[model samples]
Target: MAMERANLLNMAKLSIKGLIESALSFGRTLDSDYPPLQQFFVVMEHCLKHGLKVKKSFLGFNKSLWGPLELVEKLCPEAAEISASVRDLPGLKTPLGRARAWLRLALMQKRLADYLRLLITRKDLLSDFYENSALMLEEEGAVIVGLLVGLNVIDANLCVKGEDLDSQLTQGDVSVERDTYKQSRQGLDEMYNEVRRQLKEECQLRQDVENELVVQVSMKQEMELAMKLLEKDIHEKQDTLIGLRQQLDEVKAINVEMYQKMQVQTHTHRHIIQQLEMDLKIEREWRQTLQNDLHRERDSVAQLSTEALQINGLKKEFHRLQDENVQLKTICEDQEKALEELGSKLSESKLKIEDIKEANKALQGGQVWLKDKEATHCKLCEKEFSISRRKHHCRNCGEIFCNSCSDNELPLPASPKPVRVCDTCHALLLQRCSSNPT
Candidate 1:
């Protein structure tokens, strides 16, 4: 899956490169048409004043069209965004002004292409819709160029009619001149109306562009603020990760020690069990000997008194063995209870460790720590906190201080806003700033 995504991104980058080149070529073609535009203006002026022979190809018509035929506005939502930026530029009423605007737009276009390339070349960054939107801008450029050419052609045709009217007047032809003059007058009126309509459209377009630019500028500022916030969050998380890793190592060491202790406990329990087994075996042997002695006495009744005394001694020994057995069982039960208590302590220790971990996590996640009110002196300056000089807390180090010792407000990574820091923290921050000046 990863390999396929990489391949697709590479292909998209190549396409973006091709599109950039095409846009550059389009701009160059427009630049080359400047001379032709000047020549067309001159020819039109001559045709308007005096009749002259003219060729259709004299205007050097641009025929290098290579963009989409569809309306870009309909295809690409981003086209409006690009057009909005054009309003930020100064007006282009003169030749020099237009050229400057064109150059600046060209630079902007190149920059935009670089930005787009970076975005699309990243995996899953460019969606299908955005891709289509990019291609739409290319068609929009083509349409603008085509419109310029069409406007020049219309101007030339209008001039041609003027020249014909002039010719009829020079030949002293009354009726023909009157009709041609009226027709020219009517054409001029229509041309004037068209120009006025185009002017109104241009003004409206400019207004829309201005509104869009304001919106874009505001959005850009908001994005920059958001980016700063994210960067600070990342730094804080990295610090938390380091702290957690240290705690993990300590927990691992504790676990190892606990394992060793449990092993020792198991050995002790095994030893206790072995001692009980030996005591039980010895008691069984002694009981068997007593039974044999009793059988021997039954076989010879003449030795009854002697056997009776021996039997009493055996009974007393039996009673002593029973007491010893009971004591041994009691000792085992006591040891088992001690072992259960030890296990409970281990479990309690584990729970305490987990609670400490949770507390540490909370502190890292911006839970504020305050100094105890019992403290009477500043931690850094050792100054007494009095009614005149109140106690203050450093947001960074969570230390109590006199108000003068903790007066600096600085941007803290854990907080969204700047916070009061102690003299020690402020000095450290300054040193860090000097070490890594941006």
Candidate 2:
């Protein structure tokens, strides 16, 4: 309807004009929390959403300005970054949130006007999302875009990731802004209503004054009463004014409290981000160290293979040890990936932390498995464990031995399958088994 266009155009003018004027007065970089800037975005959202076609899918009907905004990226290469940033922004779950954020980001980049201009020019593309009479499809859209050009002078720094964009719009429309601001400003709206009521009373008083002129003779007596009533009404109005002032003070106090809370929240978010970054860095360094350990282990394996003669019997154990080292390398690769994932998954970071601690403990040394460095030769045979004659562990005694000495397999209580045991332990177990006659 003509009325819709007219109203939207007027509001667009008001929002743009108001924002520019206020932002210039702001003197500093306008942040995401600026009031007039927020209102401007709300107005732009309304303009974009006007007469948007509802597309139905599995999730029910869907309407979002983001789809149209996405077209801007295709149309103009400069907008691609903004669109990508919006897509990657955290805490924004809905398409609408993305759309809202896209608008803010575009404004921050000072290309919002240019992007909108491109969009409006491509009516052929916008037609799918918006009706012909929609604000975006009409001259009103162009006018709004032109007005946005003035906003280029203003700078905005928005932390899109920190904000709860998906959390807005549940309470009401743009008439009220952010929820916290809305809660404080609710009293202001009540004050506005009181002012309107006061204006209506004044208008009624003027009408009565006009009627009194016609009945001057009878009005003489009624005028005294009317004057007395007017004086009483003035006192009541003054009392209302004082109450309004008190309410205004309360709202101002609430706003200050909310602002302080927001500052605290922002500081906390920065602290958390810094902590995560440090954690990520530490994880990366740990991963690098693990990679180094893997390389050294591989070098030791290579040296062992070069030294050992591949006898048919020794080849099997050699292959098994080779396969075990391969698994170790694979496990290290998987762990590297898990460490890389810690940056994005802060909640599950503690899982990787414990693993890191265990690795650190092992590096310092553990009591269970005899470290390879502790013994250069087989314990029982006194044969020097060379690179090819690789040292192996007897599962029962946790002592180092050459493959030939530890190759005998016997079932251990801890293991369901037969596992490697030293010759001495193997003999002791067999003798004990024969004596028990089980």
Query: Which candidate wins on TM-score?
Result: 2
lDDT of 1 at 122: 38
Candidate 1 regions off by >4 Å?
1-180, 230-438
Error of 1 at 161 (Å): 23
TM-score (all chains, Cα) for each model: 0.17, 0.40
What value does the lDDT take at residue 33 in candidate 2? 69
Candidate 1 CA-lDDT value: 0.50
Q: Which stretches of candidate 2 lie over 4 Å from their true place?
A: 170-438
The prediction achieving the highest lDDT against the true structure is 2
Tens digits of per-residue lDDT, candidate 1, 97-189, equal: 322232234233433333223323432322222232332233332332332232321111111122232231233334433443354455556
Q: Tell me how far candidate 1 lies from the true structure as C-alpha RMSD in angstroms.
A: 45.6
Give the least accurate 10-residue stretch of model 2, judged by summed lDDT: 179-188
